[model samples]
Target: MYKQLLITGGAGFIGSNFVAHWLAQHPHTQVTILDLLTYAGNMANLQSVADNPNLSFVRGDIGDKALVSSLFAEKDFDCVVHFAAESHVDRSIEEPDIFLKTNVLGTHNLLECAKQHWLYPGAKPRTHLFHHVSTDEVFGSLQPGESPFTEENNYKPNSPYSASKAASDHLVRAYHNTYQLNTSICHCCNAFGPHQHTEKLIPKTIHAILSNKTIPVYGDGLQIRDWMYVHHTVEAIERIITKGEKGEAYNVGYNQEKTNMTLIGETCSLMDKLFADNTQLQRQFPEATKAAEGKSKELISHVEDRLGHDRRYAINANKLSAHLNFSQTGSFEENLLDTIRWFIQQHTKVSTIDI
Candidate 1:
């Protein structure tokens, strides 16, 4: 088990969930979270475990070489789970420079610092693990009948966000090969759960309905994505760090594929069910009362497609399953309802507090 660990981007949705999950599973392990607190990174995400005796938080950017080096020297982390990067495609399109600087240069800085600290002269390999959390977007789009992305898939990133992540993935592989650093990479599919920022598709659709705003669907809403609960991805992370081989990359997914339009329809149906009885929703979100009457679907509106938008992304999790003996848990409907319920609870709580 890793004694001292460093988790980058720990304030973001997936990272924050991983911290809480890790602490719960291993009460003795100490975790230090370093995050830049970007727009998507919220401190409130970590509030559940804010006072955890085994967890600590630090506000910093990974692109800062000096600060990162200082942290590595001071903490001497036995393991690093890096989730820090400019992740949103839309945001990356709006600003590509920051993505390159943070995802590419920032990753390079962490690799160098880790090399100096964990791979010093006479240092033992495999004594420490550097696990990188990446995305399936790096594989670009797939055809309707094309096979899912695997570890051996060629790099064909379409957007700046994916390009940056692809660069980082290559750098990690290079370090492992050239410098003999013990590293592992997991390229995951769409991860959804609580604490996700409202900008994402799932949360965006829910929030739009609640606020009575139009639900924008890019292009034909035919873009396909494989969705997995955040918990499953984190479990894959834990397994990869503890048992995966050095320099090998694994694809993390649950084989739950759905079109954007289909997902939205499902969400609307659930909202209708939840609001059928009582005014728990109408009292808090009057505009969304239409959901109770099954009219929320009226808000859906098609819009111009994003530039260079990939048509599909799916992952072949055989490597992760075969190696780690792990399989995703839960049906899509169950997970989707759980996610919807969480959003409802959060919105209800906030609305009540504001009243």
Candidate 2:
């Protein structure tokens, strides 16, 4: 379908990747991106698709009803993939009002606009979709060895971030029930890949190691999380938007669970190998001696833990797999290695550009 899709927060990690993936796969589709370009939203991440004729980027807040309405009127977006939000749990703890405004109110604005524009008495097709991207944190931390979160899991959001997302999810469901707006909610696990902002755990650890800075581990670092590559998450979202039932929710994950310490150690080991190989090569060339020569793991530094941090977040993606016949590439380890290599390459490129 050559549809006009509006992707909010398209400059953010997964959103940017989704936009790129969708454009590449569906060459006929056109995408308009609305992002406020917050701290986590990096325009540089979308540089690869910046010049694509099928893509348009607009910097604006989702809370701006007039702006959103104008876009709806002008672009006549057939489908909306809503990813804009304040996503960090720690940051949400510090400033919840921002989360409420962006995540809850922002979603409300989008729903209202869509309802007004696409839900008229005699609207065409009468099935425009508003896909809400969410997190598995809404289900709270699971007990040790318990089954993963499923579509039927109760909402037990603990942090400001999850609460905001839960509120948004409720709004989407309410719109579907009350106004008959077509919507689907997708709750995904922790995502890691290229162009991810450095504030997240994996990217932060990689950046710290590359810069020879201390890697901070919270608590005993035993917190478990289900990890999925960004590309896989994008694929899940596309599948949901195209094939999902209205007012339904799906969990997208790799089913690869690992503790924080284990994740950090794996990243450190990868960095160690890359740095060691480079250091040995430097020995043959005196000019390369200035390059950093040491194990990146020496930078490990444990710090205070986050308050009310979820101990574990697992997802049961049976609904996604059985219904949509969706299956991930099953390359978590390989994908992680490739991600580390990308981070190292990006660090080197940034350093070169800075000099």
Best by TM-score: 1
> Which lDDT value does model 2 have at 224?
97
Q: Candidate 1 on 62-147: residue-level lDDT in tens?
A: 98889888888888898999999889999999999999999999999999999999988987664798999999999999999999
* Candidate 2 lDDT tens digits, 47-76: 999999999999999999999999999999
lDDT at position 104, candidate 2: 97
Alpha-carbon shift of residue 82 in model 1 (angstroms): 0.2
lDDT of each: 0.90, 0.87
lDDT of 2 at 241: 90
Listed in order, each prediction's TM-score against the native is 0.96, 0.94
Q: Model 1, 189: alpha-carbon shift in Å?
A: 0.1
Give each prediction's root-mean-square deviation over alpha carbons.
Answer: 2.0, 3.1
Candidate 1 Cα errors over 4 Å, as ranges: 124-126, 350-355
